[model samples]
Target: MKQIRNFCVIAHIDHGKSTLSDRLLEYTKTIADREMQDQALDNMDLERERGITIKSHAIQMYYDRPSDGKQYTFNLIDTPGHVDFSYEVSRSIAACEGALLLVDASQGIQAQTISNLYLAIDHDLEIIPILNKVDMESAMIDEVSDQIIDLIGCEKEDIVLASGKTGLGVPDIMEAIVERIPAPEGDPGAPLQALIFDSVFNAYRGVIAYFRILNGTMRKGDLVRFVNTGKEYEADEIGVLKMTQHPKDKLEAGNVGYIITGIKESKEIKVGDTITTVERPCEKAIQGFEDVKPMVFAGIFPLDNDDFEDLRDSLEKLQLNDASLVFEPETSAALGFGFRCGFLGMLHLEIVQERLYREFDMDVITTVPNVSYNLMDKSGEEYTVRTPSELPEQHTIEMVEEPYITAQIITKPEFIGTIMTLCMEKRGTLTKQHYLTPERVELSFDLPLAEIVFDFYDRLKSVSRGYASFDYQPIEYRETDLVKLDIRLNGEPVDALSALVHRSKAEAFGRQICKKLKELLPRQQFVIAIQAAVGAKVIARETISALRKDVTAKCYGGDITRKRKLLEKQKAGKRRMRQFGKVEVPQKAFLDVLKL
Candidate 1:
């Protein structure tokens, strides 16, 4: 146990965490020199292309320290860097005794860096602050070290300097892992208790669960069962990830490994569930494990109706690996039958959408991401709406509440005014601000989740000149004067083009959406009336004129009365067609409204 160290690497998005993991794998010889690649832990193609980590990967390495000439078992779990995957980092942290708090020397502290540090602290895991990217000419190791000292209340010397890109200080990092981070604490003689931090589905191997054995030993032939599910399965194989899965005889206390159960369904082995021997099941399950609830909702529809079942199967398979993803059947007049899916955040939704197309080869159309809203009626009825189309009329609703978030943005002092203006336009209220350095500032605000779910992030990046980093946490739902703005085409409501807006800006929002719709919707033979309405009253209107033709162009010598009659006849035909014609709205129209 003393020689065994279980730890995970955590950091903000794109803070060289993946780069550090790659170097660590190389340092431990987990992968051969020929097999090494950039961001090796991010095995998914989308992950590599996007330069992000979407999954947590675990690897086992044997390091022999020269000082003691003793071999130590190192379980290094690489965590996702994006905030959407924070749940992955949380579970990885829970399954480890320490965390490698890697931060970029060039970027200093970021929005997610603070959040991840606090999560590790809350889990009571030892955090080893390491300054990375120090090999770059632009790196400011001295200044970054000072920020670390101020944040963690440690001396400058306590901060470790490393560069994953150049492989500098890699050896020191490994030695620090052995010397600074404590090994797992548990008795081998105690009842079998293991924490199933992650699980995956393999068509050939059935469900494979990766866990840290907290107590006792799990052998290859043991009969294991999940304490939460009470379903027993024969443990067919015990293995560890050495770049790839390598079979092992047994996983003992203070060690991390994977178990291959005969259970074919991945859902049978839940993340955060305890694994114990069925013959001698643990008397009590581990505490503090709770189910994950999705924080964002979006509608996903297949581009072709024939692919509906395929999309569903894809979502089910994805949910097996990602338990946080939730979905149910949904239908839309504009998009057709689809699923309303719930996700951890916007990035999660984007990844899932991309995977649906890339992995499954299914063409999908995703609606605008929306947050849950709590609504009340005059009759004291309560309801929750996940999309703008689900919102009720203003007259029937007695009170309206929206989910707000505690947002933090870190940027240069010069960009504070631009950021503040952007936030104010989104109806954000200033909470507090702190000057981190003479040239940098940290601004905090309470912003509605709806306001930022769309293009707010992109706008923030633009206004800050790509120098700002932002993060948010959901706050309580509060009462507000809100109204549902619905778009009607030719006196018929289009539920796909609806939004919930504040009463003060409802008219402006209506006008803006109407204008965008005009550009997106295709012109027809008959003029289409596009109106943005609040219940029965229309607040904004835009017209797509019918295609006009010169009716008298061929009649050069005709009477003036005959030409006028010909024009009048043409106008009457258009009026009749406008009343009865069915307009075809292109898919781009729905997308334009979502982007708006």
Candidate 2:
């Protein structure tokens, strides 16, 4: 049997994990000359466009060395670097026995890098430190090495300095993996125990589950059963993928590959599930596998009710591949039927929306993201509501509770005062503060997660001139007096654009929504009334003046097509507006109101 080494690449955002993955693929000769692309492991267009690893991708590679006269198979898993999907990262780590911790040479170790490194340590994985971006002009190898040693508690000599973009030291890194990481140690004679790392859907082959062989050989036509779900199926065919380029044949014990069962749906397979033989099943599956809970949520409604089923199917397909995302049917009396989709964070929400447009080819109206709130009624019954419309009536609500987060802000010392003042203004309580470097400080605060879920990071970056880095984890829920503000245009309510805010900021929130609506929505031929009110009290009001001349005075039969096109454009523009019965609201009315 061939020896196998499994490892994952972990890093901070934009720290070259994907680029290093490409170099490793090149080193293993998995990709041909013509197939080379920058960060090939980031196969999704959305991931590449956003410059973040959204999904954890896996590949199998073969390495042969004449010096040692040995052939080895390496299973390389590239994990997402964002804090939002850290659960996915942890699962990726669980499927491997070692990790290549990539630290940017110029930027040193950031917050996410430290967080993922801790996860690796917690998993008991042997960490191979690699200093990436060494080809950069501002590369600081010594300082970064010192930081890695101090932060990760590793020796300086253990750090491998390399440039992934230039393919420098990649071969040596591969050799290090083959030499250092222990081969799969489970007994072939024991019951089959394969950890399903990931799975994908194929039209011809069905659900291809990628798993790491831990105990026994997984071959073609084996009767396998999922230990966690107690579902049994025959492994119809077994194959491995060269994720860098093409496909390969049957994979053996100790190698990472895919098994195509007759199971047609990808939902049948999940990450962290263990597959074993039915005759002699393993005692227990892997532990510590928890469902990924979404930290941010929003209402997603189709412009037309006919698109509801399409939207549901889109969300289902997306969830099949992405086990971390969650969604369900939600209905509002004013907005009709829609979905309340949960996301890892703001960036995750944006990526999902972008995918809906680009991949699913569906146009949707999304409400401002909100955190789920725990509402306590006068009878002491507790319930969770993701949208403001789902919340109980103000009179029925005895108390309002919302989630809090412990946020860490890394910024230049010059902006410490400004950041502190801003946090305080947002009702954040200072927890702790420490100097990270001579001119950098790490400030910790206990703030409402809802407050920071919006444009708080953007505002921080803007105020700090883009030199600030922030990280937050949900802390706990605290009671607060919060109210939902309903926005109206021309006397009708815009359900999709409703917002929840503290009673103190109700007027400001109303004014801000009206202002954004004016910018996003074009002026109409008739006067448009914009009004923001809480219950019966009008807090803000603005009017979009009607067009003086909406039609051409002079026209001919030949100009019919042009006139029809103009009217169509105008009608399309009106359709884009958030309409509440007789009222026509502009698109901007629903966007970035949280910025207020």
Candidate 3:
């Protein structure tokens, strides 16, 4: 423990956390040149393509100080840089003694950047402020350094300027990490106690748990158990990360590594659970370890009913790796068997959908995502509703409360007008605004989570010309005039197309949804009327004209009565078709509703 330095790197999305981790691994010779890969810490293709860290990763490095001829062990962990994964970031911070706060030299501070820094501070971890990407010509190194000093409330003396792309100042940054960051302290003689911060599911080897040993020593072939679940298994292997798995006979206190217990079922292991020897169980589990709570939710249905069980199995395997994802079996009247899933935010929901489609090769249709709402009846009984279709009747409710979030946006000042307009359109109230730099400004707003879950981020990017970045944290549930809006095709309401919206914007939104559906739904043999309604009252409507087949083309010459009879016969057939015809909604229409 005396020679071990346990620390993590944190930053905003695209602020070079993964790149910095790569530089550190290269400098310390943890991974060889042939073995090195792009965005090495980011194992998922979604993360590499998007240039964001979605999960936290840990690895071991040995850096020898040439000045003193002494080598130190470094357990360098990289944390996710988005607000949606803050829960994972927080837990990763808890396992470390220090963190390197990387701020992009060109972009400077951001909403998520500040939020993650505060999380490190709350854990009382020693923070090394490092300005990254200094090699770029666009980098304003001096200005960003000053911002760091002001934020830390200290006269800057030891700020490290570095670039992950060019390997500039990397040596200095490594030195600061060793000299300033304290080594982790723990008792190796105590009973076994380790914390599972993250995990992954492997089909051949079962569940592999990534953990930091907090107390005692764990070795290969030991009988261990999960403290919370009371499940025991024989440790098949023990190892530290060497850019790849490197087996070790044992792991000491304050060291990070993986334990293979041969637990094939992914559901058996849980993140934040305590792991220890079955014969040497501790008196109690560690404090401050809690399950992640999901904020936004929606129903995900497999397009083919036969694949429902396959979807369930895939989700179960996914849950073994992602502790934040929660789901329960549900059935929709129109969509048949499906699951109602709970997620941390909209991005989380999207990632889940993408993975289900790409990883499992399953065709799925997702309903509009919704934030959980609190409702009360006349009898004072309170209940939580997650789907718009689950909203109670208006006559029975006493009050409705919707979840609100604090949005933080950083963008060029010229786009301020468009952003403000967009915010107000979503019923957002501006709380504060200030200039971070001469050209870039930060805007804070208190808005409902429902507003942001759909197209808020996309519109912000469009209006800001892709120069804006956003982050948000769920605040509180506030009373609002909210109503459940249902979409009707022809004459019948579709439960899968329902949504909850503010009463003030319900009618206009209904009109917009109706119009979009009219464009997306193909013209049929009979006229189709699209209507948006609240209860029995319709607020907006759109009509799709019936397809004409030229019924009278067969008659070259005929009596007027004969022509009229042919037209009458065609009208009766159309009337009968209208009564029995069903609208076949395509998958793209379900996706277009999210944009509206």
> Which candidate has the highest lDDT of all?
3
Whose lDDT is higher: candidate 1's or candidate 2's?
1
Per-residue error for 76 in candidate 2, Å, reads 0.6
Q: Judged by TM-score, which candidate is best?
A: 3
| Residue 561 shift from truth in candidate 1, angstroms | 4.7
User: What is every candidate's alpha-carbon RMSD to the true fold?
Assistant: 2.2, 6.5, 1.9
Off by over 4 Å in 1: 549-570
Q: On residues 1-596, what C-alpha lDDT tens digit does candidate 2 reach at each position?
A: 44788899999888899888888888778888698888788888888777888889988788887679888878888999887778778888888889999999988777778778888898888889999999899998888888788777877877888998898988779777877787767777777888887776655776677788777777677788988777899877777767532444444557777777777655567777999888888887867467777888988877678899989877777766677788889886555688989998887887788888888887777777888888889999988877877776788989999899898887778999889988987889999988766756788999988888877877887888876777777878999888888887777787777888878878887898888776666676566877888778889988987665545445456757887787777766655552522544443444455434
lDDT of 3 by residue, 399-503 (tens): 999989899998889999999999998999999999877877999999998888777878998999978889887789999888999999988888888888889
Q: What TM-score against the true fold does each predicted structure earn?
A: 0.94, 0.89, 0.96
Q: What is the Cα-based TM-score of model 1?
A: 0.94
Q: Which scores greater on TM-score, model 2 or model 3?
A: 3
The reply for model 2, stretches above 4 Å from the true place, is 244-253, 333-335, 519-528, 545-581, 586-596
Better by TM-score, candidate 2 or 1 = 1
Candidate 1 lDDT at 262 equals 70
Per-residue lDDT of candidate 1, residues 1-596 (tens digit): 89999999999888888898888888878789998899888778998998988988888888989899999989988888777888888888888889999889898998888988898998888889999999889898888888888888977766788988889998889888888899889988888999888877777887788888888888899998899888898889998877789998887898898888778654576788899998888888776357876788888998889899989888877776776789999998877899999998877888888887787788777876777889999999999988887876667888888889999999999999999999998999999999987757999999988788767778988998888988888888988877778888998877767777777888998999889988988888788989998878899999998888757886678579888888989899889988988877677777667766
